[model samples]
Target: MATLQIDADNFQPTITNNATVIVDFWAPWCAPCRGFAPTFEAAAEKNPGIVFAKVNTEEQQEIATAFNIRSIPTLMIFRDQIVIYSEAGALVPAAFDQLIEQAMALDMDQVRLEIAGQQASS
Candidate 1:
């Protein structure tokens, strides 16, 4: 599976439809973002079931701002339309793989319940 180039137009729909979506917020000029591209692409090929998408922050400033992305190579994982993981920095292949595994292993029902509980308390 090739990494999908995502923009503001498709971002919402993609996340809404995909069960597991990993987004890499990057800019072409950022060295870290460039360095992380191959790793992200490889992971996309390895995990055919997951949607690996890239958002170019330089072009899609609105999306980057919406997510509060302060740096390049920000990684975000969305599972069942909920953001399960988000961090700024490039990850090694091993760590990235581990994260995917953990995201896949999560019990979404429990996650939703926790969200509901938190919302209720709030």
Candidate 2:
């Protein structure tokens, strides 16, 4: 599967509907963003079950602002409608793949429980 170009219009719905989503926040002018594109694409192709989406920060400023993206090439992973991972910077292919594997291996039930516990404490 190829990466989907996501905009403000579809971003929420896409994240809400997909079981696993990997979002790349980038801009065309960023050198590192351009460099990381291929690795993101290759991962998308390799993991068809995961929804790989890209948000052009230059064009979708609203979406970028909503996420408080302060850097280009910010990567976020959403699983079960929760943000499981978010980071700013380009990762090597091995690290990226390892992240995907770790995300997939997460016990969502435990994650939710932890979230609920935190919320309750708050």
Candidate 3:
């Protein structure tokens, strides 16, 4: 599937949906963002079951700020409404593939428990 263009309008619902979502935070002005665009799309094409999405920081500052995105081309992976991985910089094809494999293998129940435990501790 192609990458979804995420914005303030659809950010909440898109992430909350029960799917493995890979969100790319970028801006048109950033060189690396442009360079990484094709790689992201290619990855999307390779993984049909995953939801590959993009949030243009310049166009959707609200969504960008919510994620505290300090740099362009940040990649975040979410599953079951929880953020499983977040990092800045572009990931090479191999790394991106590895991330997909790792995220797919997670025990979501454990992930949820960890989230709940952290919430309760605070």
TM-score of 1: 0.98
Task: Return the number of clashes found in candidate 1.
Answer: 0
* TM-score, every prediction: 0.98, 0.98, 0.94
Q: Over all chains combined, what TM-score does candidate 2 have? A: 0.98
The residue-by-residue lDDT of candidate 1 on 4-118, one tens digit each, is 9999899999999999999999999999999999999999999999999999999999999999999989999999999999999999999999999999999999999999999
lDDT of each: 0.96, 0.96, 0.91
Once model 3 is optimally superposed onto the true structure by TM-score, how far is the C-alpha of residue 45 displaced, in angstroms?
Answer: 0.7
Find the 10 residues in a row with the least total lDDT in model 3.
10-19
1-122: candidate 3 lDDT, tens digit per residue: 88999988889899887478999999989999998899899999999999999999999998888899999899999998889999999978888888889999999999999989999999
Ranking by lDDT: 2, 1, 3
Q: Give me the runs in candidate 2 sitting further than 4 Å from their true place.
A: none
Candidate 1 C-alpha error for residue 21, in Å = 0.4
